[model samples]
Target: MKLELPQRDVGLADDFSRSEPLRYLNLFRLTLAGLFLVAGPSLHLGSDSPTIFFGVSFAYVAAVLSFGFPDAARLLGHNRLVTVQVLVDVTSLTLIMWASGGYRSGIPILILIALAGAGLVGQGRMVLFYAAYATVAVLLENMFRLLSGRETVDFFTVGITCIGFFAIAQVARLLALRAIANENLARQRGVDLASQLRLNRQIIQDMQDGVLVVGEGGVVRQFNPQAVALLGAELREGATLGEHAPALERELRRRAEHGDSAHSLRADGSGKMLLARFLPAGEANETLVYLEDFDRIHRQIQQVKLAALGRLTASIAHEIRNPLASVYQAAELLREEKRGDMQARLIRIIGNNAQRIDRLVADVLALGRRDEALPEALPLAEFVDEFIEEFDVAESGARGVVVNRVPPGLEMAMDRAHLRQILWNLVGNARRHCSGAPAAVKIDAALRDDGRVALDVSDDGPGIAEALRAQVFEPFFTTHSKGTGLGLYISRELAEANGAVLELCVTPPAEAGTTAALPGAHFRIIGRVKP
Candidate 1:
C-alpha cells in the first residue's frame, strides 16, 4: 500500500545548484570592485594602466548588480546564468590584474574566490572548465606583458597560481557531492515517515475499539472516531479529557495513582457501559487508553460459548432425543389404558418433563442458528397486530391481554423470523407475569431521536427486583421450575445477530387519564429504522 505524495520540483543537485551561493559570490565581486575604484589611485595599486583598471572595475560592479535581479536566472536558465556571471567575473578580474602591474598585483586572489564559488554552485565538471579558462587568461596576460617590452615573465609563479585554482575547484567539488548525497538521504527518510504515518492513521480510524492518546494533564492529543462514539462526546485535539468524560478521566487517574487494571464506566449520552484499559505509550507521562464496548465484548464471549455448546449439544441431543421420544410415547400409551390415579400422575409427570426437555433442546439448537438472520424492513403496526392475534390463539387465557400502541407507517429493519421469535419470548414472559385483565400487557413502538426504532414490551404486574435485573438475560437462569431460562438469552443473541440491542429497562408510565401504570418488568429492542 504505497501512498502517493504530492509532486515537487526537486532535482538531483538542488543543494549545490541553488541561487544563494551565487548571490553571495556576486556580493563579494561587487565589494572587490568598489575597493579597486576607491583605493587604487591613492595606493598606486593600478600603476600599469590606471584608466583601464577603473573602467573594468566599474563594469564589474554593473554586471554584479544585474545578476542580483530575481528574473535574471529564469530568463537565461539557472546554469547558463551562473556560467555567464562566472565568465564576467573572470574576464573583469584578469583585465584588472593586467592594468595593475601583472603578476605582482593581488587580483589573482579574487579570481581564485570566483573559481571556488563556481565550483560550489555550478553543476557537474563545469568547475574544471572555469579553472582551465582562468589559467589560459593568466598565460595570455604574461605573454602580453613580455611582448609589450614591460618586464620579465615569471613562469614558475604563474604555474603555481594556476595549480592553486584547480586544487580549490577539486576540494569544492568533493564537498558539494557529499552534501548532495546527505540531502537526498534525508529527503527519502522524510518520505518514508510520511507514508507510515498515513498508513497507521488509517488503521486506527478503522478499529472497532476506541483508542486515545493522552498526554500529561489528561489532555487528549489524538483520538479516532470510535473513541468519540464510545465516549459519546465531541472530542478534539488538545481538549482535556476531564471536560468531555469526567468519569473516564477519573478512572484513568485512579489507575495511574493506584495501579489498578480493572475499571468500567457508562457513556454520558447513550448510557452504554464501556470497559477501559490503559497502557504505557513509551513516552514520558503518556498513556494509551483503549475503550471497549461492554455489550459488544459480551456478545463476542457469547458467540464463542455458543459455538462450543452447539457442537456438544448436537451430539447429546441426538442420543437423548431417541430414548426420550420412546419414553414419552410409552407414557402416552399408558395414559390411554385404565390406571390408578397415582400411576396416572406419574405417567403425566413423565410426559410433562419430557416435553420440557424437548423445548430446552429446541432453544439450545436455536442458539446455534442465531447468526443466520436475513434482515429486512418490517411494518411495525401490522406486525404487532398479527403477533397479538396469534398470541391470543396460542395462549387461550391471554386473549385481549396484549395491547398494541405502535403508530401507523412506523417500520424497522430486522430479520422476520428472528423478530418473531424475540417477540414471542417477550410477550410470553409478559403474559405469565401480568394480571389477568384486558390490556394488561402493552406493546409500544416508536422512532427514537437517533433514527433507530424502539420496540418496548411492558406488563401490569410486580416488576423484577433490582438486584436480579442483571441476571434476567443470562442463560439457564429463571425463577419458574418449568422454565428453560434460555428465552431471554436466545432473544438477545438473535437481536445482536441483526445488529440490534435488547435490554431490560424500567416500565414506562401509562397514558394520562388512563389506568395507573404498573410496576412490571419492561423489555426494549432498539434497532435501525427502515431506510
Candidate 2:
C-alpha cells in the first residue's frame, strides 16, 4: 500500500527524519571542537601553526553552535545545511591536522569520524563526496609537510586512514537506509491500525443487537447506542454495568458463578424482555455481551410462519367460499318454502353454520390481503365518530356503548381499512363481554411519551385471565364457543402491516375524570402520529 508521510516544515524533516541524525552530527562536531580548544596547545597537538589551529577550532565551535539553532535547518534546508556543516568540519580539521604534525600525529583519524557522521545524516552518494574531500585534504597536507621537511610523511598510515573513512561511510550509509525503512513500516502500521479501529467502531454502532465490552470488575469498557436502548438506561464507559441494569448484572454473576445457561432479563424502564449472550473478549478477563429483544425476535419468527400460512389458507378459503355460498343459498330457499317445525329448525342451523364458515373464510382471506395495506394520515376524532355511526347501524342495541374520548385534530398514521378492521375486532369483542351499562365500553386516544398515539378500547367487564393473556392474539385461540378465534390474530397482523402495534394493556386505568374506571380487558393500538 502507498503510504503518505506527515507534512514537515518548509525545510525541516519530521520525526525519524534526516534532521535527527544531523543534530547528532552537529553535537559531535561541537564536542570535538571544545576538546581541541581546551587541550590543543598543552598537548602540542597543533604546534605547526598554533595561531591558525586555535582560530579554526574556535570558528568551528561557533559554527556548530549556530547550526544547533532551531531555524537553521528550516532556513538552509536539511540537505544543504548538513552539506555546509560537513564541509566546514573537513576544512577545519584538515587545517588542525596540518598544524598538528601531519599523519604521524594520528590527527587524521578524526576525519574518519566526521565522514561516518556525514554518511549517517546525509543522503545518497553525498557522504562519499565528503569522504573524498577529507581524503584529498589529508594527502595535500602530507605532501606539503614532505616538501617543507616539517615532519615525516607516513604515507602508508595516511592512505589506510583515508580508506577507513570510505569504508565507514559505506557502512553508516547502509545502517541509515535500514533505519529509514523500519520507520516507514512503523508509520504505515500506525495508519492501518487507526483505520481498523474506526471501522470496528462503525460496525458496532450499526449493529442491530446491543454489544458491550465488560472488564474483569464488571466495568463497561465499550458500548454502542443499541446497548443503551436495549437496557433502557444511560450507560457510560468505565461505569459498572450494575449501576444501570442490576438484573442484567445479577444474571451475569449467576452465569459466572453457577454456570447458568439462562440469559433472559427484563429492561428496567421499558420492561422489554431481553435475551443476552456472553462471550470471552480474548484479553484481560474481558467479556463481550450481546443483547437482543426477545419479543421482537418472537414476532419475526411468527411473521415468517404467518407468511407461509397465509398463502396456504388463502387458497383453501377460496375453495371453501364457493361451496359455502351454495350451501347458504340452498338453506335460504328451504327456509322460504313451507316446512315442518323440526325441518325449519334444522334449516336455521344449516344457515347459521354456513354463515360462520363464510366469516371464517373471509377472515382467512383478509390475512392474505394484509400486505396490500395503503397507509395514510387519519384524524383520530373524526375516524372514531364515523366508526361509531357505522357500528351503531350494525349493532343497534349496542349503540352509545362505545364512548369516544379522542381529542380533536389529533391524527394517526396507519392504513385506513386495516386500522378500521382492528378497531372493529376490538370494539366488537368489548361489546360482547362488557356489562350493558352506559359508557360501558370506552375508546380513548392520547399522545404517548414516545411520540406515538395510543388508542385504547376498554370494557367494563372481567378482564382476561392471566393464564390466557399470552395466547389472546395467537391464531386459532378463543374462549367463546362460536368465536372464530382469528379476529384478534388478524387484527394484530394488520396492525403490524401498517407499522403499528396492537396489544392487550395489562393494567389500564380509568378514563381521566370523564367516566368511571374500566376494570376489564383493555386493548391498545399504538401508531405513528402525523406532525
Candidate 3:
C-alpha cells in the first residue's frame, strides 16, 4: 500500500534476498561519498578544527572500496567504521559547543544527520551508539569548563544547557528508532512481493503455450521460461526482437496495432510448426503470444478427422437404411411363400447379418470428422437444457441415460446443432456406465468470472476412476458394454471444434472434512461466453 515503492519491491521474493540488500548497500556508500564532498570544504566546525570534512571523506571512500570484497568489508566491521565516524562527529560538535557558548551554535543539526543515517544506512543501535558518545562528550566538556574557572556561570544556567543537548539527542534517537522500524518493514514487504511474482512467473512458464511479453517498441520485455526453452532461443532483458524469434516479434507488433492481419496464423519457424496467438497476457499494457506445440496441433488434426468421419457416417447410414429395408421386406416375402425351418433360418440369418453391418457402418460414420462452422450465439444454459430434454425423450435409458437441462438465456459461442451431438454422447455415457442409482445424471451451466462460460454434466452412476483423467481425451477410448467406445472420444473432439474444451472435471473427495466441495463424476465445456 506504500505509494513510493515500485510494485516489484513490495514483498516480491527471489531465491536469494541478498540482491535487495546489496542494492541498499551500494546506495549507502555512494550517498555518503556525495554528502562528504559537498559539505567538507565549507565546514568551519564552529571554531573547532575538525576537518569532520576530511575524516568523513576518508570513511566514505573506504566504504565504497569495501563493497568490492565483502569478506574484507565485514572484517573491517561496521562497528569500527561507524565508531570512527561518530568520534569525528561528536568531537567536532563538542568543540563547537565550547567555542559558541554551550547549546547556542548550529551544533544541534548534527543530531538530524545521526537519525536520518540510522534509517537509511544502519539500525537503531547505530544511531543510539552515536547519541551516547555525543552525550558523554558534552558532559565531559562542561566538567572541564567548570574546572578551568575561566567559565563562570550560575548552577541553573549550566543545568539548562545540559538539559537542552540531551533532550535534542533523545528526540533524535527516538526518531531514528521509528525510521529504522519503518524501513525494515518496507524492505520485508518488498521481498514478499518479489517472491510472489517469481512464483507466478514459474506457473506461466510451465504452461504448454509459448507465452511472450511485448514491451515498448515491440520489445520482448518479459517472457516465460518455457518459451525460451521451446524456441531454443536464449533471451535476456534487453535482447532485440529479431534475434530471439523473428516471426513472433513481428506478429506481436502487427497484432498490437490491430492491423489487417489474420487473427489465427499457423507459422513454420525453422523446422518446427507453431500456432501464433496474440492476447492481452497477464494484464493490460502487455501483449502475450501463445504458440501451441505439435501435440495440440495433432489433436486438432484428429478433430478434423472425426468431423469427416461423422459426415461419412451420416451419409452411409442414409444409404444402408434403404438396402436394410429392402432385405427385411424380401425376407418377409420368403417367409410368406415357404414352410420349412431351413427357409426360416436362412431368412433370419440374412436379416441379422445385414442389421449388424448397418450398425458397424453407423459407428464408423460417427467416428468421421465434424466439419460444421459455428456462426451464431446460443444461450448456453437454455441450449444444454433443451438438448438433454430431447435426448431423454428420443432415446430411452436402455443403451445409456441422458439428463434433462435447459437453462434459459445462458449464452456461449457455439453451433447449437453441433453442440447437441456433443451433449448427447457425454450424457449418454453417464447414464449407461453409471449403475444402481436410478440412472444418476446431472447437467448444469454457470458464468465464470475468468471470462469463460462453463457447462458441467455429471453422474452419480459408476464414476470413472482417478487414474484415467489424463488419457480419456485421446481418440478411440471407451468403456462401453456395446460397440465402439467412440462416444466420449467423438464428443470431446466436437466440443473443441468451436474453441471450447470439454474436460472431465475433477471432483473433491467425500469425507474430506466439513470444508470439502463437490466430487461427482463431471464433464465441463469451457470457452468464451457471449456478452
Candidate 4:
C-alpha cells in the first residue's frame, strides 16, 4: 500500500502561515509594544527621554490604527491587501524607531514583519525593495550609535538584531512564493471541474433517455430536456411524486421508500413503454431514473413476427397432419399383424415420435393467442403443495434428479391454472436437462415480513452464462436438442398473466456448493401476497 502524505506536515502549515500574516503580525506587534510600554516608565535619556518615549508611544498607537484596512481597500484581493499593509508596517517602523534615537532605543532591528510581507508580495522588485530598506535602516542606526558614543551603546547587540531580521525575512519571502503558486494551481483545477460538469449536463439534455435529478426532499430539482419532451411536460421545480409522470413518480417513490434498484414504469400519455435502470444506494432519499424506450421496439417486432408465424402455421398444418395420420395408422396396422420383435419396436418408435410432433404443433398454436388469466386470492401453502403433487415431480429420484429441501406452508395469491402451467414447464425441463444429475431440483417459497412472497424452483444440472441470460426470455430461445424450446417462454408468459413476475435466477459461483453447473439456469416467480 502506498502511504499517504499528510497535508499539514507539508504545504498546509505554510499556506496557513501565508494567509493570515496580518493577524499574527498584529499580535506580535502588540506584544512588543506592550513590552515597550512597560519599559517606558523605567528608562531615561538626557532629560529628553520623556519626549522621545512619548513620541515612540504615539507612533506605536498610530501603527495599531493602520492595522485595520481602509474601507476602499477591503474589496481588493488578499495579496494586494497584504502588500499594502506591509508597506504601511515598514513605513511605521522606520519613522517610530528613527525619531526615537534609532538603535539607541533598540527598536530599529524589528524587521520580521517586513520579511514576512516580502514573501506574500513575491520576488523580483518587491524582494529588492525590502532588502534595500533593511540595509538602509541598519546603516542609519549604526551611524546614530557612533554619534551617541559609549554611554548608550551596544553595537554587538545591534549587529546581531540586523543579521537575525535579514535572515528570517528571506525565509518568509520564499515560502510566500510557494503559497501563491499552489493557490494558482487550485484555481485552475476549479475551472477544469466546472467545464467538465457543463459538458456532462449538455450530453444528458441531448439524450433520448429521460433524466431526472431529485433532491433529498423528494422533489424533482432538475428534469432534463429529453424527459420534458417524452412526457410532454412543462413542469416546475418542487413537483412531488406522481405530479407529472405518475408511473415514473410512483417508481421513484418505491425506490425511495424501499430502496429498490429495479423498476418498470410505463406512462400512457406518450403511448410508450418505459423501462428504468435505477441507481439507488440504500441511503438515497430521492432517485434518478433513466428511461429506456424498448416497449415500442418490442411491439413492432412482435407484430411482424406473429403475422409471419401465423401464415407458416396454416401452410404446415395440412402437410404435417396428413403424414402424422399415416404414421399413426401404420403403427396400428403393424400391431394388428403378426409381427417380429424388431418390426414391433420400429412401429412403436415411429408412432411415439409422430404423436410427439403433433403435441409440438398444438403447443405452437396455443402460443399464438394472448394468454388470459383469472387472478384470485390464493392461500400460499395450498398452491405450492397442489402444484408439485399434481405435476408428479416428487418422484424426482426415479429420474436420478434430487429434489432439494422444500419450505413448508408457502403461500401467495396466484391463478390456479397459471400456477399449474408454470410448474409443468419447470418439471419437464428438469427431467430433460438434469436427468442423470443427483436429484438436484428444488422448489421452495418464503413469505417475508412485509407480505411479499419469493418463490424459487431451481435445478442443479447446468447454469446459463452471463452473456446468454439477457436473451433467455425472448420467444423460441433455447439450448436443447429434440425440444420445441417454448417451455420457459410460455412459463414466463403465464406467470405474468397472473400478475406475477417470472425472472431467471442466476446460478451462484462454484464456491457455493448448493448452486448448479455454471451455465445451468433457475427460475423465480415473485409477487405480493393477498391483502
Best by lDDT: 1
Instruction: List per-prediction Cα lDDT, in the order shown.
Output: 0.84, 0.83, 0.60, 0.63
Each candidate: how many clashes?
Answer: 0, 0, 34, 14
Q: Write the per-residue lDDT of candidate 1 for residues 147-262, one digit (tens) a residue.
A: 99877458889999999999998788667665655666677889889999999999999999999999999999899999999898998999998889888889989998999876
Write down the worst ten-residue block by lDDT for model 2.
Answer: 6-15
Tell me the RMSD of model 2 versus the true structure: 20.7
* RMSD values, in order shown: 20.6, 20.7, 13.5, 9.9
Model with the higher TM-score, candidate 1 or 3:
1
**Error of model 1, residue 330, in angstroms:** 20
**Alpha-carbon deviation at 357 in model 3, angstroms:** 6.2
**Candidate 2's TM-score:** 0.56
Q: Write the per-residue lDDT of candidate 4 for residues 273-358, one digit (tens) a residue.
A: 67766674245565666777776558788998889778656645644666578677777767777758857776876776676677
Candidates' TM-scores? 0.55, 0.56, 0.41, 0.53
What ranges in model 3 sit over 4 Å off? Answer: 1-78, 84-96, 103-274, 280-296, 299-357, 369-531
Q: Is candidate 1 or candidate 2 better by lDDT?
A: 1
Residue-level error in angstroms, candidate 3, position 440: 22
The TM-score-based order of candidates, best leading, equals 2, 1, 4, 3
TM-score of 1: 0.55
Q: CA shift at 205, candidate 2, in angstroms?
A: 2.0
**Candidate 2 lDDT by residue in tens digits, 194-241:** 999999999999999999988877898999999899888899998998
